[model samples]
Structure formats: C-alpha cells, structure tokens
Target: MAFFTRLFRPARASERRFSELVGPHIETMYRMAWHWTRNTHDAEDLVQDVLIRIVNRLDELEAADKPQPWLIRVLYYRYVDLYRRRQRSPVLPAEDCAETGFAAEAESSVMDKPDRLALAAQLERALTSLSDDHRDVVLMHDLEGFTTAEIAGVFGISEGTVKSRLHRAREKLKGKLHGSF
Candidate 1:
C-alpha cells in the first residue's frame, strides 16, 4: 500500500501542475485548433489530443521560456500527423465537408457586403489550392502574425525556406485571384 501510494502521488501532482499551466490557455488552443480544422468538433478533438499528449511532458512544459509557442508547436505537429493520416485513409477530405458557417458568423456588416464576401470566398478557395506547406506558412505569417523565424522554428526549417514558401504561396494566390481584384 505504501509503494502504491508513493507511485501515484507524483502522477497526481504532475497532473495538477499540467492543469495549472494549461488551463488558462485552453481557449487559445481551441482558437488555433479551430483555425486549422475549421470545424468545431474536430477542433475540440485536436485540442484534447494535444492536451493528452503533453500531460506527460509536464517537466518540459514547465521549463519552457514561452509556453504558448511550445504549445502551438505541439499542436502543429499533431495537426500534421492527423492530416497525413486522413490522407492515407479512404475518407472524405476536410475540404469536401460542408461549411461550418464560420464565415456567416463573421461580423454581420462584413457578411452583408456581397463583394467583400465573394472576395473572401475566392481567397479561401485559393488558399485551399496551395500545398499544405505553402498554406501553413501563409496562414502562420500573413494571417496569424507569427514571425518567419518563429514559423521556421515550429516547422523545423530554415527561415529562408519559410520566407520562400510564403512568397511562393502569395504568388500562387495572386495567380488564382488575378481577375478577382
């Protein structure tokens, strides 16, 4: 009984510490997950997966200088893994799924403007056409405001590569939206 009690105490403490560190960021995690998944249920699952995976790494999370970036990096890798797994399985692609009405839920003033809405839809379609790497870089830098260096760190690539990918992605978008402007 003493041995079992000793074994379980640290696990419980670690879980408590993990919750303390991660609880405040749950909303942020969900938002980032939703941005990538664009589906409420999938986003929730993704955040839950990240939380479960990182709980065992409480030491690392506690020692990190910036927990938010660390959390985002973990989220990114998990998203990539899930993305690849879905690719291998014979299932409906995320894009083919029906819209989750996020766009409609946008600022009503913006939604009411047909021209802006059409342009937004065009841009989204063009984004979907890019390769995953390109799209991820573009979204991280242009949309999410992450620095190129930060993105490179997250992707485990060189900063130059991140810049190149961002540039190419923008060029591709421009080509796709040539007449829309």
Candidate 2:
C-alpha cells in the first residue's frame, strides 16, 4: 500500500527537486530540437515529443543531476529517429502532413521575403551540407555556445573531437557563406 501510494503521488519534494534542478535547461532542449529539425514547426513537434519522453524518463536521472546532458541525449536520439524517417520518405505532401495533424504552421517556414530570405535559405543549405558529426557539434557548441565539456558530454565525443569539428565547421561555413566553395 505504501509503495502504490508513493508511486501514485511521487514525493512532493521530487517535483520540486526536478523543477529546481532541470527547469532552467528546458529552453535549451527546445533550441536543440529546433536546430536539428531546421524548421520551427518540426522543431516544436520534436520538442513536444521529447518533453513526453523526458517526463517519463525523469526517474532514470540520478538525484541532483544537471539534466542538460540527459536532455540532450533525448534530443539527439529523437533527431536520429527523425533523420531516418526523413531519409526513407524524402518528401511528404502538404496535404498528408496536414491531414495527419503531424505538422504545426507556427514552426515551419523558410524566410518570407526575397533578399534576406535568400541568405537565410543559403545558410540552411550550407548547414545541411555538413556531416552529421560536424553539424551536431556546431549546432550545440558554436551556434548554441555549449562549452567544450558540455558539447563533449552531449555528443559522447571527446573535447578534442568537438574542437576539431567546430574549427572545420567554421571554415566550411565561411567558404559557403562567401561563395568561395
């Protein structure tokens, strides 16, 4: 009876603990998801799905943990899943996506104007052209400004590898943006 009761109502203290500990990082989770998806709509959907998983997986987290790395792990795995599904399909008709209620208009767009939008589109193209390792490292570390150590933790790669990827990615972005590639 005590076990069931505890299960039903996780100690009030635990909720407080989780919020105090991980709440601040929740925005990072959303940004991580958004970066991976490349569109606001898909990012929001991805983050929403991850939110459910994070809630379910909270118990697996050690007490007094930072929760950022674990949250990145969730986002990374989900992005992998999403990347696979995208490769298999390659394209989804607008009607199908809308009919299935799988998309959100609020989060999905390429710029709305011509000149500025063109540059943004070019930037996205450059980003997608990168290898996954480089793209992930750059997204988390350079664009989002995660520390070398934090990025290493997020990608399960060495700090050396993260630094290497960031340097290479910067070179690549420069060439691509300058039309020198």
Candidate 3:
C-alpha cells in the first residue's frame, strides 16, 4: 500500500501544481477568447481547447518563467488556426447579429446616458472596421491593458512592430471617431 501511495503522490502533486498555475488565468483566457471569437459559446470552446492543450503539454510548460504570456500565445495561435479552418469551410447563411442583443442590453443599462451608448456604438463600428491585426493590437494594448512588450511576446513579433501597429490602429480609430463626432 505504501508503495502504491508513493507512486501516485507525485502525480497528485503535479496535478495540484498545474492547477495552481492555471487557475488564476482562466478568466483572462476567457476574456481574450471572447474578444477573438465574439461569441460566448465559441469563446468557451476556445478556452477549453487551450486548457486541454496546456494539460497535454504540462511538462513542457512547467519550465516557463512566466506562463501567462506563453498561455496567451497558445490561445492566440489556436484561435488563428480555428479562424483559418473556419474560412476554408463552406459559408452558411448569415445568422442574426448577436451585437443587436448586446447593444439592446447596453442601451437598457445606460437609459439615462444616451451619449454613452452612441459613443460605444461608434467605437464598436470603428473597431470592426479595422483589419484583424490592427484590431488585435489595439484591443490587447488599449482595452485589455497589456503592455506593448507583452503584446509583442504574445504575437511573437518585435516590440517596434507592435508599437507601429498600435499607432496606426489608434490613428485610424481617431479618424473614424473624429468623423462621427
């Protein structure tokens, strides 16, 4: 019995350590996934896929000094792969816009703040108009509060490229918003 217990103890310890490392970042992963997928179900699926990959590669990930960036990089790549696969598939007829429901909810919450709703709508339009790469940098750096260096790390690009993308994205956003207001 002691021998069996000793054999299982390391496995249990590793499981606990993996949980400790991953538990805190689940929400962050979900948020990033949500932004990429723009649908709750898809975002949840993406995060689950990421978590499964992380579990399978736990031995590899265990050695990283900071796992968050690495995990995010995994999430981003998974999303890109999924996006590519989706693009290759035959297109189905368009579904009703989910943003309508979100906008309705936002409208209800800000009944007394019409200006805020208009601003949010405008911003959403502006964001949607940008190319995916530009939107990603802007969302990660400006909305999600990731540093430029962190964004560079996640995208596996140089810091200067991240800065350039961010600058161009912001400039485009400014132009769009400037015209709207």
Q: Pick the lDDT winner.
A: 3
Q: Point to the candidate with the largest TM-score.
A: 3
What digit string (tens of lDDT, one per residue) describes model 1 on residues 1-181?
A: 2312232233577676876777666766676777788787788789878877987898899998767768889998999899889879987754626554445445366866888777667777788889988988887788667889888888899999999999999999999999777
Relative to the true structure, candidate 1 reaches a TM of 0.73
lDDT of 3 by residue, 8-81 (tens): 23357767787777776777777788778777677778988887777868877778777877788899999999
Best first by lDDT, ranked: 3, 1, 2
Worst 10 residues of 1 by lDDT: 1-10
Candidate 1 overall lDDT versus native: 0.77
Whichever of 1 and 3 has more TM-score, that candidate is: 3
Using all chains and alpha carbons, the TM-scores for the candidates as numbered come to: 0.73, 0.64, 0.81
Q: What lDDT does candidate 1 reach at residue 76?
A: 85
Regarding TM-score, does 1 or 2 come out ahead? 1
